[model samples]
Target: MENLIIYPENQKQLQILKSLLEEMKIKFKSEEQVEELQDWQKEKILKGIKDIKEGKFSSNDDVSQKARECIK
Candidate 1:
């Protein structure tokens, strides 16, 4: 079996898609119905956010320079 993903623009479109899928008897899961994030994933995301708030990240130029140096 193959899986398909769909992104409806607005609530109306989403409702229409859900209705159509129900009419066709096709099973589908919406984003809100998905499982919760794992603890490690959540921790990493929170750490990244904290680092950003603390201004601990490097600039794009610094990253590019490092990349160029590594490529040498």
Candidate 2:
């Protein structure tokens, strides 16, 4: 059998999915549930988001050579 990954952003959507799956009698195993963010990761992601929001970003090549796609 193959595996299917289902990701729902919030509790409402997750509850909806649970109801539907229960109604259909589907078998599923939820290993780990997504939870609230940690301070460090949240800060990092927020910084990145703010950078995009404030138009603060680097060109691809500024960070890595591989990102500099070339054609000849």
RMSD of each: 7.6, 8.7
Q: Pairs clashing in candidate 2?
A: none
Worst 10 residues of 2 by lDDT: 63-72
TM-score of each: 0.55, 0.40
- Enumerate residue pairs that collide in model 1: none
Each candidate: what lDDT?
0.94, 0.83
lDDT digits (tens) for residues 1-72 of candidate 1: 889888888999989999999999998888888999999999999999999999999999999999999999
The positional error of residue 53 in candidate 2, measured at the CA in angstroms, is 50
Candidate with maximal TM-score = 1
Clashes of 2: 0
Give the per-residue lDDT of model 2 (tens digit) for 1-72.
888899999999989998999999997767565467899999999999999999899777665654554431
Query: Would you give me the overall lDDT of model 2?
Result: 0.83
Native-to-model Cα distance after best TM-score fit, residue 57 in candidate 1, in Å: 0.3
